[model samples]
Target: MEVLINLTLNGLATGMLIFLLAAGLTLIFGLMDVLNFAHGGLFAWGAYSGTWIYTSTGSFFAGIAGAILTGLILGLATEKWIIKPVYGNHIQQILITLGLMLVLSEMLKVVWGPNQISASPPSYLAGSWELGNIIIIKYRVFIIAVGLMVFALVQYVLKSTKIGLVVRAGVMDKEMVQSLGINIQKIFMMVFMVGAAMAALGGVLLAPYSGVIYAEMGLEFAILAFIVVVIGGMGSFPGSILAAVLVGLSGSFMAYYVPSLSLAVNMLLMSAVLIFRPQGLFGLKG
Candidate 1:
């Protein structure tokens, strides 16, 4: 029972972090069809920039704020300067974003030096609570709480707000929405910025969980997130969360029970999902 609880908590924490990232990717890559390989660059930037501010200001919350702000600003610049020009060209989008990914990563080394920096949770979230044979980490619970809040907030926005309705309508019938005099370009930009901010938040949160931050970490996790996106179904928000949780729990259990197969499990799962249901578990056939 203790082992079960521990693994559940661990998986939940990891899932939430991935959800933060995958949620944004769903908006940009899934809905807007941006294919933004540089989204992870925003994440890496958040870790480095947010951590720097946290260390400097002695406040973790402030670091989160800094990261979100940085992501929003960077997202705007990238959408306008980099992505806008290559909007309709998938090949160009892939090439440009991939190149930008490398640039953002290298720029991290330039600014912070080529070193892996360690991160620690704030004092309030530094320890664990013990219950009989089980121990629950405060930070992990906090992460789960944050993930739930984000999921709920996003759902609320998507369901209740005018902007959310328009975004959803845009995703389904972009031409029709545009015919109604809606500036889909601006909506696309907003989605990109929000997605970037979510990715940044994930990065900042992950630093403490990972205990170290590196530039290439973005690509590594981005791969996992891509897998999640594929498994969850393109443009399906709820599907992303469910798929992320499944991936997280599977990884946790596999790592403990079959360490050698831990890495292969993700690939195997993706392959199986591809083979069995190409549209993914929740994907729609548009």
Candidate 2:
């Protein structure tokens, strides 16, 4: 029972990280109708920049804030300069984003060196607490807390705010939203920035979880994020959360029990979802 509890918590934390990335990707795709392969690059840059800031300032919170700001700036720049031009053309968007992904990823190595850097959890979040037969890692709990907070915040923004209404409307019909006097282009930029910030947050949190930050790690996790997005249903924020939790829990338990099957489990899960529900568990049919 204790083991199960521990695994569940661990899984939830991992799920939250993946959720952050998928949330951004799905929203961008749904709202802007853009397939952003460069999303992963934003993540990698966040990790690199956040870690650097944390090390320089010796403040973990500052690191997170810095990463978010960096993500917003980069996202705005990319959306305006790179993504905006490729709108309405899937092939061009893909090519441009894929190329941007490479450039952003390479820039990380150039700025932070190609070698992997070890990142330790903050002292306050380090170590574990024991509860009877169960032991829980502090950092894992922190990650879970942060993830839930982010989820709640995003939910509130989507459900309660006027901007959220515009976003939802745009997602349903961009032309109508624009016809209603809303600046669809400006909304697009805002959504892109929000998504980028989420991805950056994920990257910053992930650095301590994996204990190291590297350039290629972005691509690896981006694959998982894409899977979670597909399984959860693109453009469905709640769907992304559900899918991420499923993937995280599966990976956590499978890694411990099945061992050899851990790597294949996510793919199998994705395939199963694709077979049974091509629109994803929560995705709306177009």
Model 1, which residues run further than 4 Å from truth? none
Instruction: State every prediction's TM-score relative to the real structure.
Output: 0.98, 0.98
Judge candidate 2 at residue 14 and give its lDDT. Answer: 91
Number of colliding residue pairs in each model: 0, 0
Each prediction's Cα lDDT score? Answer: 0.89, 0.92
Instruction: State each model's C-alpha RMSD to the native.
Output: 1.0, 0.9
Q: List the residue pairs that clash in candidate 1.
A: none
Whole-structure CA lDDT of model 2: 0.92
Q: State, as a TM-score between 0 and 1, how close model 1 is to the true structure.
A: 0.98
